[model samples]
Target: MSEKEIYQRVEEWLSRMTLEQKIGQMIQTERMSITPEEVKVFHIGSVLSGGGSSPGENKPADWVKMNDAFWAASVEEDEKHLPIPILYGVDAIHGHNNVLGATIFPHNIGLGCANDPELVKKIAQSTAREILATGVEWTFAPTLAVARNNQWGRTYESYSEDPEIVKSYAGAFVEGLQGDLKTDSVIACVKHWVGDGGTTYGIDQGDTDISEAELRKIHIPPYIPAIQAGTLTVMASFNSWKGDKLHGHKYLLTDVLKEELGFKGFIISDWDGCDYLNADFHQTVAQGVNAGIDLFMVSEKWKPFGESLNQHVNSGNVKPERIDDAVRRILYVKIKYGLFEKPRPSARYWSNHESFGGSAHREVAREAVRKSLVLLKNENDLLPLKRDARIIVAGKNANDRGHQCGGFTVAWQGVSDSMDEESDEPASKITTAYGADAGVQRGKIIGGTSIWEGIKAMSPKAELNINGNMADRSRHDVGIVVIGETPYAEGMGDIRQGDETIAEMATKIKGLMKVLHPYGHSLVLNELHPEDLEAIKNITNQRIPAVVVLLSGRTLIIEKELEESTAFVAAWLPGSEGQGVADLLFGVYDFKGKLSFSWQKKAGENFRKGDEPYNPLFAFGYGLSYSNNTEN
Candidate 1:
């Protein structure tokens, strides 16, 4: 639709909405909030499920029912209210990540290594299909942060440290998800609007101290292509530019993003994003609305937020023109998505489709896994072992299915079950059903294969050892150690946020580096577990030529581990398809992935770009292949 037609339709709808309804249109409540009746009375415009937030059973059908309830209520209105449909949003960053049994594709870090825009677009399309099957219509994804620092907790969310690669991906992913915005397509929301990946010391939501010129050069280009690709919504970042919170930065959010860049879509606040504006609620609401945030993602405080916004507008703190603009942008997105014409999510034709985690989606995810593996070392070609060779696969990650998918799987922080005694399953054949409760088991990995499962399938004689304590190490011709990061997301992944100094942070990380690191629903953000080093040291001490497979979201401090290993492979958080890792390991597929971020030799080192490169352990785009060719 043209700008005039969109505004005309918006103005026609605006003519019927009261101040209370307008305020309600600005509020986005969570799923666990008040009942559907409350949604009808309040005229809530949107609903979202934060990480791990799901309906009873966390199944696709249940998701459809839950979303349908809210959507039904929003459209049920009297003559006093406007019967606008509500938009259901999710963090379907890597597939419909919130839904159980959904196909979990490799995270963006792995996709960055793949470096294929067409593949990224296909992944987004598959993700949208799964999300639509569960009745969701909007996703906060294609995070366009040009990560300049790897220590940032959300590094995996970014595609690359290079702005050009990010620029390449932003539009492809948006177009993939939005897919002509007609059928089985969801609203593509390009996120964390500006400079979230450039924080100092890789702090999460910290300040970016770069100049406006650098910001325009490095951080702003991705959004331009994404916007041009017809993204319907953009999320405001939690991070600040020059110490100013992006949620309240009118110059960037309004002048740069909307006016200067010509982004016609709406700007939505992050979860409680305006809370950082000020202590006073009304003032913060005014700042956010005036700063061009169209939707307020208020989780628990929607009622109060709506009241405050209404009061601010009534008091003239927020101008009517700003309110009209915000509402126009929001209504335009809803209209553009055809939400008004379609019924609830459960009523859509694609809802409850059989392709949520069907073979086709899983195949795509498996292909992504194969393309995401980066071989860091291959001393004397230790990999591609004969199918019948004797091998010992050790390390906590070797047999752990939950660890393979990493964070943002079934739960917010993905399942982190260790290979302990309690998890031992009978040596039964792999099961097809990884029910809602299925996770890592002793002899059988659930939901997906582990590196050990892959190796054993390729070489059935291989022994699966988790602790590396097998009595006869000399029995094995070659040992493969699968070890790396435990699952993490957001604040829990931040490496240097709270510590006063680098030494203090390193000391803290070292203290938690042992077994059973504190696990929580949210607050824990431990760095790469140190047990990989201990396991490698143990394996190499026995003179076992070790080939280490590092399963992590980002490159870590692995110089010590590198010293003892005969070969190394950077198997980034390959989600739900362990056989792909096995395929590359056993020469079923060549190592085609490259390093998206410069591999750091030290924990405190900064991220390296190709230009003005630093002395990284490995440069950006570096990777090894079985053909003995190193690509950079």
Candidate 2:
């Protein structure tokens, strides 16, 4: 049948159903508590596995069964909605980072480093395959944030402060995901519209204090390219634009984004954002409807949103036309994805080994990890360390898989240690980073060392010392002290404040670096804070060459370090790849990555919870290297 006719069929079918049935179709729940029976009873529309949410049996084959279970229930409920399927969604930011064995490409920040639109496209395509394997057909990704301040806990989430770069990259991601969106290709959702990354104080969902013109320039470019690519969905920003809330700003939501740009897809709000109208969530349902939000990521509280919406309609606070408009847009997106004709199957059984996280994808994922590594500083050819030099690896961050994986891996924020708390709980899923399993171990191979075994199989007549305490030192040619902030998400990251709580622990690094000082040893400072510079400044000024490496998801203000350090590096979070750091430090790899976002300046006197300035210490896309490149 023609597309429009099928849409009509679904809409007609929906019209015949009860309000409970329609609401059920609009509802999407977390994979937890979701079953085929729930779908048949609730007539649910969609399902998702939020960042760390996974199934009891996480194997690829098992995932297919779980997804099929949800699909089976929804289909069996009505059997009237056309051949289209129920849309499934995932946060496939930088490949399918959430799923184990799937290729985890560079984060958007790292993608910014490559600065290649084509590379971005390929990464998205790789991400789509894994997403499809789990039986999901929608992806909430290609975050279109033109981040301004590096201090924003989510700095790593933005590709750049410059709009041009964000836009170019966004287009590439959309094309890759929807290039030929078949049953295999997942639909892309361009997100957090307008000024999400411009929050004044970098609060997660705080205000963005800026003029309209500035907002348009510094923060809105990515969406333009996203629109051109026919991205299936656009999640509204939790942050506001200028002084008005985005969730309630009719001007930007309806007038500008819809009327001006002509976005054809549905507009989904950030989680729980619809309840944030006028800063009073309890009554936001009516306000959001009047503001033009199409589909809200509402949960059990959805009935409140619906009830408030109903009240607004009764009170004439929201016109019926607006309700119809929102529902039509929602219906439009469902139809566009061919959800009406081939509605997702509801059988909890499958046989596709190719689906879900697998081997071929890991090869592609490793390339992203390698290329995204940026070498910020190199003196006396310190990097690509001498294969023969004795190397001592220190710090809690050196070899723990849990810390190495970074945040948003198998849980929100992240666990402190690698050992699974409960095997019964789903194992934390992540792209295998570092070591032999992921090629990040190239450096470890050169050094003939493995943190787990404390030495290599080859022996090489070498003693490899792994020290959690810096003071308990072993004489070495080079001391690679791995340091960095532990994992946390946006709001939690801000709460942690510089992520230097490891200070009590870092006394060990300070003590050990000093004890090893007399040996002319070079220290590899991995992902450390700039404030900690004072601790090492005296040595640095004495020209005691030290290489500082950053293993953060965001950039830090490091003017003092740049001025006094031997060298500095930005190692964007390489998931489960401690070996990547080893490879680069031991000379197995070259410093090839550039800065993804601007290096933040210390929040000065003007810094507040929601105020942002235009300038920063280091510009976006900044990186240095001792590569063999001559000026063309």
Candidate 3:
């Protein structure tokens, strides 16, 4: 519809909504905290499932039923007179990541290495289809974070350190997700608004202590294309810009984003975002509304939030016009997406469809994994292993799908299917976590293939051993040690933030570096499990060639390990689809990925493109093809 038509519908809807209903439109609650009945009584505007939050069944049909309940309540109309369908959103960042059987794609960092904007758009389109199948309407994705610091926990969420790459691909992802704002597409939210990527010392939600000009130059450029692509919403950053929290930054949120950038859609607060404003709840609401946050993702605190917002509006502390403007934007987005026309979840085209985790989606994820694999080192042509060669896949990650998928799998931290219980055998020695024994068809594999299984499929006689002994290695022609960081999201993944001077911090870093020094680059000690170095040493000690398949969210200081090992490949958390890794390993596909982030030369040494003493182990865009370049 045209702007005039959309605005006219928005105005007509706004005219009928009561003050309480208008205020309700601004509050979003987590599904666990509020019910369908509460959604009707409170006239709650929207609902979200935080990471790890799902219905008891945790299936696509269950997700649809759960969302349908909230949708049913929001549009009931008996309580508040007029009905505005609730906008449901999820962190479908890499895929519809929350669903167990959904096809999991490479995270943004892996896609960044692919450097194909069109491919990235296709991935988003794939994600939208899976999300739509489950009846979800919005995705908090296409994270435009230009991660400058490798130490940042959320670095994997960024497309690149270069804003140019981020700028180039942001709109494609947005377009892919919100394709013409049709029923099959979910609204794309270009996220964490301004400078979440430029955080000081790579701390999560830390200050982006840069000048406005620098922020504009480095961080804000990506959003321009994303906005131009017709994204229906932009999520405010949890990080601060120039010492002011973005959730309440009036100039940036309202004047700059809305006025200067000409962003027509609504702005959303991060989860419990307004709580950071100040101790006074009333003042926080006033400032957030005045600063132009159309929707407050209060999660569980919507009750008090709604009450406070109403009091602020009635007392004239917050102008009703601000409320009207916020409501107008909310209704505008709802109408533009045709949510009013197709309010019920089950009525949507893809709703209750059995196509959630189809083979086609998995094939695309496999392709992403195949394209994103960076062959950092290949000595004596150790890769593309002879199909008949006896192989021993060692290390915890060799057969662990949960570790391969990383965080944001079935659970908040992720769950693993343990093919190798203690009673299973020597090959399955590594233990899996969480839902290892869930009665899913493939156990915890959940439409995923482990690297060990992928390897076995090609080389049926290959041996599987987590910590292979000398006898095992002596019998095998080649040993592939798949080892890297364990699953973690947000804060858990960050290496010591600059301010962490705690005794435990010092002890842990020292212990980690001590265990990791043998592998090379210990000073920039990553959160490497103790078994990683042991596995590599166990394999390399023998005469057999050792190929290290390193899985991580970002570069680790692995200069020594790379030298000691016959070959190394950097697989940045290739989600599910272990066949992709196996495909390249066994010569079914060639390596095509290049480095998206710069690899640090040594520990305690990290630099972006512009930094001085700019030595790196491997520069960005560095990679090796299977047919050529066999040197280190």
Across 98-206, the per-residue lDDT of candidate 3 in tens digits comes to: 7768888887888888888988888888899999988899988889999987777778899889898899899999999999888768999999898999976666666
Q: Residue 27, candidate 3: how far off, in angstroms?
A: 0.8
Residue-level error in angstroms, candidate 1, position 451: 2.5
Higher-TM-score candidate among 2 and 3?
A: 3
| Count of steric clashes across candidates, in order | 5, 34, 6
Which RMSD does model 2 reach against the true structure?
9.6
Per-residue lDDT tens digits of candidate 1, residues 200-241?
666666677789999999999999999999999999998777
Q: Which stretches of candidate 2 lie over 4 Å from their true place?
A: 1-20, 33-35, 77-85, 278-282, 307-317, 340-352, 417-475, 495-547, 558-567, 577-583, 586-589, 600-621, 628-632
After superposition, candidate 3 runs with Cα above 4 Å error: 421-442, 470-474, 497-527, 630-632
Q: List the global CA lDDT of all models.
A: 0.79, 0.57, 0.80
Q: For candidate 1, report its TM-score.
A: 0.91
Better of 2 and 3 by lDDT: 3
